[model samples]
Target chain A: MFEIRWHSRAGQGAVTGAKGLAEVVSTTGKFVQAFAFYGSAKRGAAMTAYNRVSDKRIINHEKFMSPEYVLIIDPALIHTADFTANAKENTKYIITSHLNKEDLVKSQPKLEGKEVYVVDCMSIAMDTIGRAIPNTPMLGALMKISGMYEIDFFKESMLNVLRKFPQKIIDANMAAIQRAYDEVN
Target chain B: MAEKIDLLETEVWDGNMAASQAMRQAQIDVVAAYPITPSTPVVENYGNFLANGYIDGEFVMVESEHAAMSGCIGASAAGGRVATATSSQGFALMVETLYQASGMRLPIVLNVVNRALAAPLNVNGDHSDMYLGRDSGWIQLNAYNAQDAYDLNLIAFKVAENHKVRLPVMIHQDGFMTSHTAEGVKTLQDEEAYAFVGDFKPMNAMLDFEKPATYGVQTEEDWHFEHKARQHNDLMTKVYPVMEEVFAEFEKKTGRKFDLVTNHRLDDAEVAIVAMGTTVDTAMMVADQLREKGIKAGVMGMRVIRPFPFAKIAEVLSNVKAVCCMDRSSPGGAPGMLYNEISGALYNSAKRPVVTGYVYGLGGRDMTVEYLKGIFADGLENAKAGKPTTPLQQFIGVRGPKLNFL
Candidate 1:
């Protein structure tokens, strides 16, 4: 089983991003689960969402996870939430921040020895999607870090997931994904 | 005819969405609901379907959960298929009407997203609401995942509307754990699903004015006992066979087999964990891990909670040396309900196992894999000792202190 955890605020679309990832992975005929824990949480309050993918039916429902990948859509959550609570030794971190890996580690010493990748998902979303919804862009960075799918194929799958939106909004999202996919370091 | 919905062969859905789709496929005539947390989406989605002309049904918006069920009872008695959804406080408010729906023999399907009742005000999943409705004369069916929630809703209509067993049915899924969690659910086409549920056959419906009949008739001291006794007898004897027939036919059509009780790796096992809802699936996973370490572990889940499945439960656990009854609801002051029921079931067995009770996951507290491993470890010890090594009834996953009671 492969587990991924996302740290974001209540309204930031972590749950939507996780479900979108699950939707694409499930099309490959693997079982997937996406869920979140919100205990009467309000907007802007820090929260976490999760995704699990496996070849066999996934049945474990515990909120606790030793996540293999950690995606932080809200950089401030790095200070607020315990993003490393149940991390695996080889867990990979893909974070949305203006700071590069060096400055990020210097500011938050807890990530000193971690395998971290940086992407400006917030700015990417703002520039391409005309909004600060960093979730889709975060997924793009995740794809780059994990190599879970080809960039073009992942973007196409996401188009179907976002099919309900207007053509312009969908195209903007596609651009957001591509920009973050290429710009992540 | 209701408009058909085009769906993918597999759709990503939460438990609430799955249930709503089932309601739409069943092509229900009425859904009177007052929405609440977690469960709100089930009816909300149904209302959307109604608004989109996908359903030829009345979506009655009522004031409270009491009125929500009261509307369902009225619509059902008027000879239309009816359903609703509720949880926690909403369920508590519907308690009185629940008995009415059953006593009147109204075949209203209720999707109960199980949650904890509150003075502390929790909106998360637990079996408190499920346990509260156990004695209300409804045939309760539990779902461990989104797919089960979908399949069981369709099955509930068939079972509840059966002429031999005209009782309201409740399909329960864990509140947030199942209702809010999204997963890939294999869906049946609308035509296939509607055909399996068939058409509603309203017996003694008030709408049939030519054959004028009475409902909710007052039963005084002379007849109340007989009324109660007959209802109890039918629940004990009649519902099981009808359920068996429905389950068999469903499996034949859909290839998803359902039984009164779910047995996982129980054969040739020495110790087992008995649970319900989503916990059953987790326990089954843990049982597999335990087996690798050479402990013969297994799990038994109750699919049919109201009829209790006494004989089936006993037969399944008859061979195991020890058992743990993991009840997600608080027992208040006594042993957990499953612990008491399982003990009673095995009281006369020829090879009775040592049974222990565990109270866990109250108000949506996480029942991690580690806690299940600990429970299985105790089960192994109890099996070897031929008695409980831990306390007869203990709480798992709670903080502050180790709490146990007799």
Candidate 2:
């Protein structure tokens, strides 16, 4: 089993991103679950979403998880949310930030010895998708860090998942994914 | 004929979406709902389907949950297939009409996304609403996941509308845990689903003027007792056979089997956890882990919540040495509902196990695997001690001072 948790504001599309990842993984005939803890929260309130992928049926429904990957779409959540809670020994942190990994570690000394990757998902989404919805860009960074799927295959699968959108919007999201995939380190 | 909405063989759906799609495929005649959180999507999706020309059904925008259920009851009495969805306070508001629908034997299908009733105002999953409706004369079916939510909606209509058992049915799923959680659900095609549910058969319908039957008639002391007795009797005897038949036919069509009680590794186990709703699946996973460490752990889950399935409960737990009855709802100064029901079921049995009660996950508090592990450990201890080593009833996963009540 593999688990991932997302730290983001309620309106930042963390739930959508988690469901999208579950959708892509489900096509591989693996069991996957995507859910978020909604606490009567407003749009800007800090929140969390989760994903579970397993070879067998995924039956655990508890919110607690020893997540293998933690994706923080809202950079400020790194300060507000407990992203390191219930983390595995080798848990990887893929965070959205303006600063590089070293600078981020310096600012938040709690991540001093942790395995961390950084990308400016907000900037990437604003430049490509013309919105601060950093969810897709965060997924792109997750792809690069986890290598769970080939970039092209992941993007193609994402196209099907996002096919309900207008062609122009879909193209912009694809570009946003590619830019974040390339830019994250 | 309504337009058929194509679905993938396996679609990623939350419990709310799955239920709404099932309502659509059943080709219901009317959906009267006032939406609530978590459950809002079930009716919201149904309304969208109505607007998008996928369903040829009337979507009534009622003012409140009371009006929502009244509209369903009115439509059902008038001889049309009717359904709705509600959660928490909405369900509470609909409580009076719930008894009306069941007493009148109007087979209205209700999708209840179970949530906590508020004094503090929460919108998360709990069994408070589900427990509130237990005595309302409805056949309650519990769903553990998105797939069960979908499949049980279809089955609820079949079981509720069976000529021998014309009772309202409520399909309960954990509010945010199941209703908002997205998972891959294997779906039946629209035609296959509709065919399985069949057309709605109305008995003593108000619209059938030639028959001239009266409904909601006032019953005095002379008749009310007999009416209640017959209703209770039919629920106990009539519902089981029809439910078994519907479940068997459903399995023949879909290769998925459903029973009054679902057991996991209990045939040879000494200690067991009996739970309902989503907790059942979680307990099964923990039971498997406990078995790896040779604890002889097992799980029993209630699929049919009312018409309580007492005989099945007694039969399944008869062999286990100790049983934990998990209740996700607050018991209000008493032992939890499941604990009372299971203990009553075993009271007349020849081999009565040590029964323990656990109150957990109130108002959407999380029930972790660690919590369940501790519960099972207690169950094993009780089994070994031949009595409860822990308190008779205790609250799990709650903060502050530990609370243990008898």
Candidate 3:
């Protein structure tokens, strides 16, 4: 079983990212569950979403207590939310941030040994999608680190899921995913 | 009986989306709805289907849930297949018309995403609204997850529209727990689902001009006693058979079997838990863990909350030494609803179990495995001693005070 927790502000589409990843993974005939937790939702309050992927059926519907990977869509939440709550020794982090990995490690020494990759998701979204919606790029960085699916395959599946959106938005999101996939270490 | 559902397509849908899809497949004639959190998406998605031409139906946007049900009553009484969705406060607002719908035998299907009633104003999952509507004369069916949320809506329409059971039905799912959580749901072909639900057979419809009818007539002291007696007794007795027939037909068509009350590993068990909605799944998980430790633990999930399924419940729980009834709604000082109902069901049984009440996870708090284990551990101790370890009724997982009342 693999679990991923997402942290973001209300409008950042962290829930969508988690759902997109779950949808993509489910096409492989794996069991997947995705959900978000919030209270009195507002425009910019902290929110959390979760996804569980496994070869076996998942029976537990509660929030993920031990996530193997934690993805931070809003970098500011790193200081506010406990992004690493119940994180295991080998749990990895994929954080959307302007800072490099070393700078992030310097700021939070607790993240030194565990695999931490920081990508400038906002810059990628600005350069590609013309917006600061960083969820797509975060998923792109996740595609690189997790190897859950081929980057092209993941992008195609995501676009298929986003077919309801306008063509320009789809193209821009695809571009953002590609840029983040190529650039994130 | 062997005809199986061909998985022509599968979609990952939350409970609201799945229920909306079911409504569309049923080819409902009208949907009069007012948006409410956790349940808004069911109606919203149905409206989307209408606009996108997936369904040719009237989507009436109303000012409040009361008006929504009033509109549904208007549409359904006009011989149209109608449905709507609501939760928590919206449901509370609609309570007045719920009795009207059922008393008039309108057969409208309401998708109730269960949520807690509020003063602090929470938008999270619980069974408070579901419990509130228990005596409102609607047939109540509960779903544990998204797939059940989808399937039960279809089943609800069939059972509600049955000639013998022409009462409105409320198909309940835990708000947000099932409504917003996405999981793979195998859908029947639109044609198959429509065939399974069949066509609407309007009974005493207002639109039948040839045969005039009057609905919602006042019943004064002279006739009110018989009117209510017939309605309540017919509901308590006739609904079960119609539900069984519909469930049997559904299983034959789709290979998913449903029972009034579902038991997991109850045979040869000494300790058990009776619960509804999402907690049923949680209790089942804990029961498995208890069995791993060689404890004779079992779970009873109430598939039908109304018509209370007393006989089935008593038959299943008779031999258990200790039973915990998990209620997700605040009892407000009384013994929990499920606890009271289960005790009433077991009142005359040959072997009485030590039934206890547990009010837990109100307002969408997670009923963690650890908390559930604590419950089971306590039940185990009670079973060994042949009595409750704590007070007969206590709230679990709440903060600040450990509220216990007889």
**True contacts recovered per prediction:** 0.75, 0.86, 0.61
iRMS of every model, one decimal? Answer: 0.7, 0.6, 1.3
The order by descending DockQ is 2, 1, 3
Question: What DockQ, between 0 and 1, does each candidate earn?
Answer: 0.85, 0.89, 0.67
Candidate 1 — which pairs collide?
none
Please name the candidate that would achieve the greatest DockQ relative to the true structure. 2
Candidate 1 residue B391 Cα shift, in angstroms, is 0.6
Better of 2 and 3 by lDDT: 2
Name model 1 segments beyond 4 Å from true: none
lDDT of 2 by residue, A1-185 (tens): 99999999999999999999999998878899999989889999999999999999888998898999999999898887889998988999999999988999998988988999999999999998999999999999899999999999999999999989999999999999999999999
If you assessed candidate 1 against the hidden native complex, which CAPRI class would it receive?
A: high
Model 3, residue B273: what's the lDDT?
85
lDDT of 3 at A135: 89
Candidate 3 local lDDT, B1-406, one digit each (tens)? 1122234366788899999989988988999999999898998888877877788778898899999999999999999899999999999999999999988888999999998898879999999999999999889999999989999999999999989989999999999889999988878988789899999999899989999999989989999889889989988899999999999999998888999998899987898888888888877887887899999999999999988898999998888988989999888878999899999999898888888889988889888888788778778888999877878888888889787877
Error of 1 at B84 (Å): 0.3
Query: Over 4 Å off in model 3, which ranges?
Result: B1-8
Q: How far off is residue B229 in model 2, in Å?
A: 0.9
Q: Fill in the DockQ of model 2.
A: 0.89
For each candidate in the order shown, give its overall lDDT on alpha carbons: 0.94, 0.93, 0.88
